[model samples]
Target: MLAALPVAVLLFDDEGLAYANPEARRVVELDATAASSPPHVEAPAVVDAVNRARRTGQAIDCELERDGRQWQVSASPTACGQVGVVITDLTEVRRTDTIRRDFVLNASHELKTPVASIQALADSLRLATERDPARAASMLESLEREAARMSQLVRDLLDLVRLEERTGEEEPAEADLAELVRTQTTRVAQAAAEQGMDLRVDVPDVARVAGSPGDVRIVVANLVDNAVAYNRHGGTVTARVRRAGDEVVLEVSDTGIGISPEDQQRVFERFYRVDPHRSRRAGGTGLGLALVRHAVRRLSGELQLDSTLGQGTTLTVRLPPAPTSVAAPAQPPPP
Candidate 1:
């Protein structure tokens, strides 16, 4: 019965190591020859736990790290003067806890900045309304900007959460990649113009992909938005879409202050900013790339980034092409 247990289990008698289940043998690399040896030789931490349980006449639960993995060791004193030890792997659980803690901390820090600004601005606006009407008008604008920033932040957070929670159980409908690129690019063209950046789009008449339209929109909009937001004055931002064999490819390139080699590795991390001051000034929530990454993954796509410091940057995404059977019929020639 003990041998059938899934978790690693070891039985130690007064003499020495008495029995070890298959799991225990596999986990600790124990063999028949080692059965007669003391348990400490195999796992010192397990031995210590067993000793503590035997001494106290109760079960002892402890966590330990071994071979770069987290493990939970539970030792119980059997009724017949033997000790039973169970070892369970906890690496994934511990990793998840760490990620959760970090996310909460980062989110709180991101939110606190805007909340504090709004409070301060409100107070100043009140004072200026009575003393200086002109200044009060400017304060009102600033207040509105801050409020909008906070609103955008909240919406992005919700979108990211939704994308992460998706289980890929629902079948995705076909989306027009070319149309998505054109619409997203057009939406950001005014912003590009205001910055004196030339915007361009190159796409086939019909490029279709199998994915959620919302997910694809997020991916396209964020890419275009980032290109416009981080570009240099009079620079060029180009978006291109093409069908490559089994994949639909979208590429957004920008002539901006490119990312350094070191920063490229973490560009997709939530709330991470390569240039925090510039990001805030551009009304960015620092979640654009993170959202793009998640949305692309949800569509079973690949994202690539190439940047040269002081030169330029380009981002590429490849998604599964929609099956020919479901491809949108080519539109009738402009009547």
Candidate 2:
């Protein structure tokens, strides 16, 4: 009967451990034949719960943490003074709760920024239009900018939700990484030129993967756009596509102010910025990397980040190559 149960179960008598099922022994990391308490299950709360259940002949419940994992623990007293203990793993449950909490808080903060700006801009425009037409025009421009920002934020939030809800049931199709790299690089070349930066594109004749074309483009566009946006004047950005075994790789490297170690770990988090003030001034919504990460996951790909404090940052992505039989029709190389 204990062997069929899902949760870990153990019985403790006055001597120490009277009985421990396989689940209990595995979770507690203790010898089932040992007559002492488990060393790894040393949470004081568990001990207290067991002692209280024995002393009062009443049931007790508590939470215990061990080795970075959460466990729900319950102790019930038997008629003979033995304690029946049950433990349920709660690590994944706690993780879901944390993700939900952070999403709500971060979403609220991001939405509030542009909404507040739009409101303040509207008030300034109203007052300035009556007395200062030139000031009113500037306020109107500010209002438009804030409105656009809010719109973009909403769009990005929707994209994140869609990615999170992905079912992985969509049929895959051939998508050329080289084409995506070339198209995205060209689209941003003008922007890079305007910023006095050079954009370099190096790609193979064809590098294809099995995924949605639109999704691939989104990934490439965001990476290339960020490379251009974060780069310094006269700096250079490089986009590359190549094949590694059964995988195709897409890489974007930028000569911008690199991310600090602390920020690098959180750069993929929604609305997380290395420098909030600088990011805002650079017109960054802070959702680009987050979206890129989610899109890559949906493609069953891997993303790697390499950066230094003052040098630059590089993002590399690898995905399974499209099957030869299903590869897209070959197109002429870009001139």
RMSD of each: 3.3, 3.4
TM-score of candidate 2 on Cα atoms, chains taken together: 0.85
Lowest lDDT 10-mer window, candidate 2? Answer: 325-334
Angstrom error of the Cα, residue 233, model 1: value is 3.0
In lDDT terms, which candidate is top? 1
Q: Please give, for residues 155-183, the per-residue lDDT of candidate 2 as tens digits.
A: 88898888889894787587888888888
Residue 307 of model 2 has an lDDT of 93
lDDT of each: 0.87, 0.84
User: lDDT per residue, candidate 1, 223-291, as tens digits?
Assistant: 998888888999999998866667788899999999999999999998889999999998999899999
* Per-model TM-score on C-alpha atoms: 0.89, 0.85
Report residue 29 deviation for candidate 1 (angstroms): 4.2
RMSD of model 1, in Å? Answer: 3.3
List, in order, the clash count of every candidate structure.
0, 0
Q: What would you estimate as the lDDT of candidate 2? A: 0.84
* Highest TM-score model number: 1
